[model samples]
Every structure is written in structure tokens, then in C-alpha cells.
Target: MVHRIHRIHRIQTLPVTPDKAWDFFSDPCNLARITPPWMDFRIVSGCADHTYPGQIIEYRVRPFPLVRLGWLTEITQARSPVFFVDEQRRGPYAFWHHQHHFAAVENGAAVRMTDLVHWALPWYALPVRALVRRRLRIIFDYRQHALERLLGRAEQGEDACRA
Candidate 1:
């Protein structure tokens, strides 16, 4: 069976500076705030104050009813207040690489945040793309709304979140 790579891209603008956005996102503890309640996501350990290369973060989450999962990711690359990349060391997916980028806009009055994820499922789960896609949509949509509610929304731009 051929393992297929799926991609999700999302862009959001927030009424805050790049520094402020980085301060919140760089801290691993803040992940729970943007995650959906249904996921029951929690940081098990290794949540440092800020992200850096080689940092490991551990998390537990319920991706489906009656199912719990452990997700371990390593911050492979981080450039302060600009971009960071995290790759799953162990998790539900066959592969997971997520990149987060932030830029100052409107003369530093606002921040534009972008998320790009490249992932693939195990061979056994390859046929369930529809189900997986729906789940991902829900999770990302919730994240977008949650961030907006927390940081105040700026004018939204193109959203290319396709799984």
C-alpha cells in the first residue's frame, strides 16, 4: 500500500504584535488553550517556558470516544518570534510535521500566523481519509475560533486548510 501524505495549511491574523504572538505560542503550555475541548488534550511533561531546537514535549489526548493517545513531538527548529517546526517522534500518525510561522503586519500593530502540517496515517488507516479529514477540520476550526476569542480577531485572509 502506498502511504499518502496529507497537508493542511491555515493562516490567521490577530490584533497583536509578533512578539506577543510568539510569547504565547512559544510556550508549550499554551497549546491547550487553542485545542478543542473534545480532544481532552493535556501536557504530560517536558513543557518548557519557550521552544528551542531539540526540546521535547509530551502530551496526552483523546482523539476519539473511549480512545486515548500519547503524542510526543520534538521541536526540530525554532527561530525566535518568527517560525518553528515540530515533528512527531511518536504519535497516532505514521508521520507528522507541523510548522508555525508568525509575521508582523500593519507596522507591527498586528501579527499574521500561519500553520502548515504535513502528515500521513498508518497503512491500515489509509481508507478512512474522509473521517480523518472531518476530524481535522473540526480541530482546526475550533483552534481558529478559540484564538480569535482570546486575542481579538483581525481581518482574515486566505485559508487553505485542505486535508
Candidate 2:
């Protein structure tokens, strides 16, 4: 049976309006731009105009050396400029659920972005915890940096990454 395994929770505040945050993030095509190059992440199909619930996104990713995985994920939920959730339909993991949340702070001058991910590898991959923590941190760190650059970087409450 696939059991609950681990979670990756992160929060990042940016110096941008809620609208800007929503617009950039809601655009599905920008994913490849933020993802790390080594993963060889490529989107095979998805909508580019706007985001809505029940969207199916397909991709090809090389999660590890020489093993290419075809990932199919569904946008299970989306609530305008507030939050959205994506759950894996098929992939390397036994289960994967990711939630992206955004909120306006500083009276529309800044926004906070939070990502909560619950994921699990197969039972045989039990030893992955030790190695994966560091790698996932690296990936999220890169994402944070990319978001900061993309959203103009928060000069005020620049929280020291809570990944």
C-alpha cells in the first residue's frame, strides 16, 4: 500500500503585487523556465492562456541519470489569485500533491508565496529520505531565487528562505 511519507513546506514573500504574482505563476508555460536544467523538464502538453481547475498537464522529466519519466499531473484546484493545487496522476513517485498559495501583504505592495508538497516514493525507495532532502532543498532554493528575480525581489521582509 502507498503510505503517507513526507512533506516539503516553504514560504517566500516577494515585493510584488498580488496580480503580478498570480499572472506569472498562473501561466503554465513558465514552469520550464523556473525548473532546473538538469532535470530536463519538458512540457508535452498544457494550456498556455490561463489556469483553471481540472487541467491536465503532461511532461517528460529525467529525474535521475538515464531514466526518463513521463509525468501526468492534474490541476485539481485553482482559486484565482489566492491558491492552486496540483496532484500527480502518473509519475515516478507513489504519490505527489503540491499546493501553491499566494497572498497580498503590505497593502498590495508585496505578496507571499507558500508551497506545500506531500510526496512519497515507492516502498523500495525508503532510503531516499536522506539523499532527497538535500536535493529537494537545492531545487526549491533555485526556485526561490528564480521567483525573486522574476518578481523583483523583496527588499524589506526578505525572509531567509523557509524551504
Candidate 3:
């Protein structure tokens, strides 16, 4: 059996300060706010108000009808108002590494947020790879719109990001 790692890179600029962007993303509790409602995402345990190295955040998510999965991810790196990295410790994926980066843009008037994810499905899931990729795109697309609503819209003429 062979496994392949897939990557997704997305970037969005919002009309918010860097601190505000970092504050919202660094807290595990706000995840549900930005995620699509259909995912039925919820924090199960091991979550704190703020993220830190070695912080384990557990979640229960329903990706399909009448199905539930436990996802556990550890914050391996956290740099305030800058970037954070999380890696999966257990759950659906064969591997998952997600990085969230934030930077001030437009001379501190706005924030440019970047999401880079590296993930792979278990061998058994290989047959459904296309479906998985499409599902992920839908999830991230929902997230982008949700964030704009929660945080604020991007500046006019700003480049939109797609997964």
C-alpha cells in the first residue's frame, strides 16, 4: 500500500487588527464559530481559553449523517499574534498537520491570514480520495465565509482565497 500527502493553502485578508485575529484563532473555543454548522463540530475536552505548546484539543465532529468521529490535535507550536501549528494525535486521518499564520497588512489596517494544511487519509480511505478532497474544499469554503461574517469582510478588491 502507498500513501500520499496532500496540501492545501489558503489565504484571506480581513479588516481587523493582528491582535484581534490572533486572539480569535488562538482560542480553541472559537473553532465552532468559524466552522460550518453542518459539520456538527464541538469541543469535547482538553481545551483552554488560549493555545499553547502541547495543548491538546479534543473534538467531536459529524462528517456524515448519523456518524461521529473523535479528533484529537496537539498544538505543537504557538507564537503569539503570528503563527501556530497543530498536528493530529488521533482520529480519522492517517496524518494531519495544519498551520495558521497571521500578519499585519495594509500598514496595520488589516490582517492577512494564511492556512496551510498537510494531510493524508488511511489506506482504506484511498478509494474515496476524490470525495475527501471535495469535502475538504467545501469545509474550507464554508469557513472562509463564516470568518468574514464573524470577523468582518475583507477590503474591497482584496484577493479571495479558494481551497
Candidate 4:
């Protein structure tokens, strides 16, 4: 077996209270809303409520043409208005761990999302590393853009009403 490790850090600014930010970000179903519809990502389960420790979220995503993939992840730790950690229970990766953190900043709140994932193919580890690295970057970029759009919409609604 081979080991490929990846780490990503992203910071986002949102003009919302910590509770509100946590409420929006911690909802697993909101993930479907943020993900690009072209990817055909759908929540298979765990959309009933907000996250909690040991809660599992299942997803179906068509990342490539005519190929659908299933991912199962469980929340390892959860602390409201602070942070939570989730790891893959079963999925494409051999190992996947992600930590989501939130904090209050000057104007609103700043969110720090990090992922420490390690994955390798059954036999072809080297080539898989290169391919997976690029894929992870693209996935995270999509997530960042989606969060920005959500925050932008919330801000705009606030501005419109105030005008």
C-alpha cells in the first residue's frame, strides 16, 4: 500500500454572528446547496438535522461522466460555534479527515476550514497521488467559491432591506 497526504487551509470572512455562521456552516444539507449542481452531488442521508458526534452523512456524487460515487463520513467531534472534525467512514479515500473551525472577527466572523487527507489506490499509488492531488484542489476551490456566494447573498439581502 502507498500513502499520499494532503493538507488544505482556507479562511473566509462573513458578516454574521458566530451562532448564525455556525448554524449555516454546520448544516450538512447546506453542503448540497453550495456544491456545484453540475457535479450532481446529493445528500443520501444525515440531512435531518445539524451535526453531532458520531453522526454519519452519506453522499452520492457524479464527479465524472456517467460515473457515480458514494461517500460515507462520520462526525468525530462537534462543538457548536467553535469547531468540528469529520472523517471518512467509507469513500474514495483510504483516509480522509477534515476539521471545520469558526471564530468571531472584527466585522463579523472568520471561518477556518482545514482538511488533512491521505489516500492511495490499491496498487497504483504514485499515479493516483498526482491525480488525487489535483482533484482535491479542485474540490476545495469549488467549496470556497460556494461559501463566498452564500455569504454574498446574505450580505446583499441585508443591504437591500436597509436601503
Candidate 5:
């Protein structure tokens, strides 16, 4: 099999306490909520509970036309309010690993979410890579927007209390 690897790195800042931010992100269900409905991500496993090492989460995603796939992954490392790492056990990708890092910053905290994925198609390598990259960008953008909305709601609540 051929291994084609790609990495996606993102940094987002939120105006909330580390505990609060961690609480929001630590819930796996939040992922489904943030992800665009068009992607059609359904948790095949590990959604009934929060994440922990040795937990395997499987998803079935219909990302595009004629591209329905299964992504099976296991959480290898997890540190509450800090970071977590997930590696693909079986999926569309030949191999996939993702690490999510969070650190407290000026206002609240900075999140650095990185995905190191290795995947290859039986044929049409170039097209597959291009398509994956484009779809990942859209997914991350949707995540950012969802985070902003969540934070905005928190801020509005604070303002109301202060008023």
C-alpha cells in the first residue's frame, strides 16, 4: 500500500476560562454539533461517553458525492483540559493521527489542533489529496465558527449578569 501523508494545523483563541473551554471541547458530542451537517458525520462508536485513552471512536462520514467512508480511531493519549491524541485504527486513510492541544492564554486559552494523516487511494492519488485538503479546510472553518458562537453566547450571558 502507498502512504500519502498530510497535516492540518489550526490555532483558535477563546475568551473563556480553561476549565470552561476544556469542558466544551472534551465532550465528543460537541464535535458532531460543530461539524457541518452536510458532511453527514455519524458516530458509530464512542459518542455515548467522553473521551479517554484506549477508547475507540468510529464514524461514518459521507463527505461528498460517492464518497461515503468509515473512519475508525482510538484515543491513545488524553489529558483533561490539556490535550488528547487520536490515531486511526481503520479508516479511509491508510493511516491517520490527530493531536489536540490547549493552553491558557491572555484572555482565555489557545487551542492548537493538528491532524497528521497518511492516506492513499488505489488510483488517482492527486485528486484524492486535493479533495481531502479542501474538505478538511471546510470542516475546520465550520469548527471555528461554531466555537465563536459558543463563546459569544457565554460573553452575552456575562454581560447580562453585569448589567
Candidate 6:
């Protein structure tokens, strides 16, 4: 049997339109700004500054201390102001799929952002699932805080979280 791991991040709502939220998250260049610097994550090739359907991205990443791995991912889907999906083609992991979703709040003054990631390492690497899960959370936590600083609240700074 193949083991799979799934993780989801429901980030705090942002006081912005779906289109605004989508624009920031969809831009490939914004990744580095939001990512934690200690990971030493850097884009190696494949339009790291642009994003489009069928776009391929290559990156040099350090998942562990002094451990660097090359990762390649494809933008399988890209729809403006709504969602996008990226899947791993060549990377350290056996499998990886990530979905980014955005929805406007009922009041239309805020947007909700969500990230769902599914991944699996090699068969022999099953023992690292716990560690991987923990690390993922930490990574996402960093992203959440970054977004909050960027578009977390409106200029009015009202509490605009969704109901």
C-alpha cells in the first residue's frame, strides 16, 4: 500500500477582493517574499518570476540542515481570481500536489485563502512522515504571517474575517 500525506492551511481572512488576493498569490515572484529565508529556497529556472497554465518551475530547496534538493513543479491549472494547482514533475518527493483556493467573503470586503497539499516521499522514507508534517506546518505558519502583514486587514483595519 502506498502512504499519502495531506495538509491544509486555512489562512486568516484578508480584507481584500478575491482578485486582489489572487493576484498576489498567483505571482511566482511573490513566493520568495513570503517564504521563510532560512530554508535557502531559491528559484533555479522555469519562469520563477511569472506564472501561467502549464508553466514549469524549478527550485533549489533545503528541507534539512545542509541538505539541498532540486525540485520541479508544473502549474497544471491557473484561473484568475479563483484557484491554481501545481504538481511535482521532478523533485525529492515521490509525489506532490498543491492547490491554492480563494473565495470572497459574503460581505464582499474580504477574501479567504486556502492551501491544500498532498505529498508522499519514497517508500523507504515512510518513517519521516511525522517530521515532514511538522515541518510543513511550520512553513505554512510562516506564510500565514507574511500574508497577514501584506493584506491581512483593510486600511480601516476593521475585523473583517468571514462568518
Top-lDDT structure, candidate number: 1
TM-score of each: 0.95, 0.92, 0.95, 0.81, 0.80, 0.86
Residue-level lDDT of model 2, residues 77-135, one tens digit each, is 99989999999999878989999999899998999888999888878876776676677
Q: What is the lDDT of residue 98 in candidate 5?
A: 78
User: lDDT value for candidate 5?
Assistant: 0.68
Error of 1 at 7 (Å): 0.4
Q: Write the per-residue lDDT of candidate 1 for residues 1-163, one digit (tens) a residue.
A: 3388888989888899999999999999999999998899999998999999999999999988998999999999999999999999998889899999999888899998999999889898888877887899899999999998999888755545554
Return the lDDT, model 2, position 143. Answer: 86
The residue ranges of model 3 lying beyond 4 angstroms of the native Cα positions read: 160-162
How well is each residue in 14-83 modelled by candidate 5, as lDDT tens digits?
Answer: 6776677768766777778888888888887687456789887889988887788898888899898788
lDDT of candidate 3 over 34-54, digit per residue (tens): 888888999999769899999
Model 6 global lDDT (CA atoms, 0 to 1): 0.77
Q: What is the C-alpha lDDT of each candidate?
A: 0.91, 0.84, 0.89, 0.69, 0.68, 0.77
Q: Residue 153 deviation, candidate 3, in Å?
A: 1.1
Q: How would you encode candidate 4's per-residue C-alpha lDDT over 1-163 as one tens digit per residue?
A: 4364555555555556778877987899888877767779998988856889989899998876797889999999989988888888887766677887776665454433333444444444566566656766677667767766776423322111000
> What global local distance difference test value does model 4 have?
0.69
Runs in model 4 with CA error above 4 Å? 107-126, 153-163
lDDT of 6 by residue, 42-113 (tens): 888775444678998888888889888898999999888888999999987788889888878857788877
The TM-score, computed over Cα atoms with residue i paired to residue i, of candidate 2 is 0.92
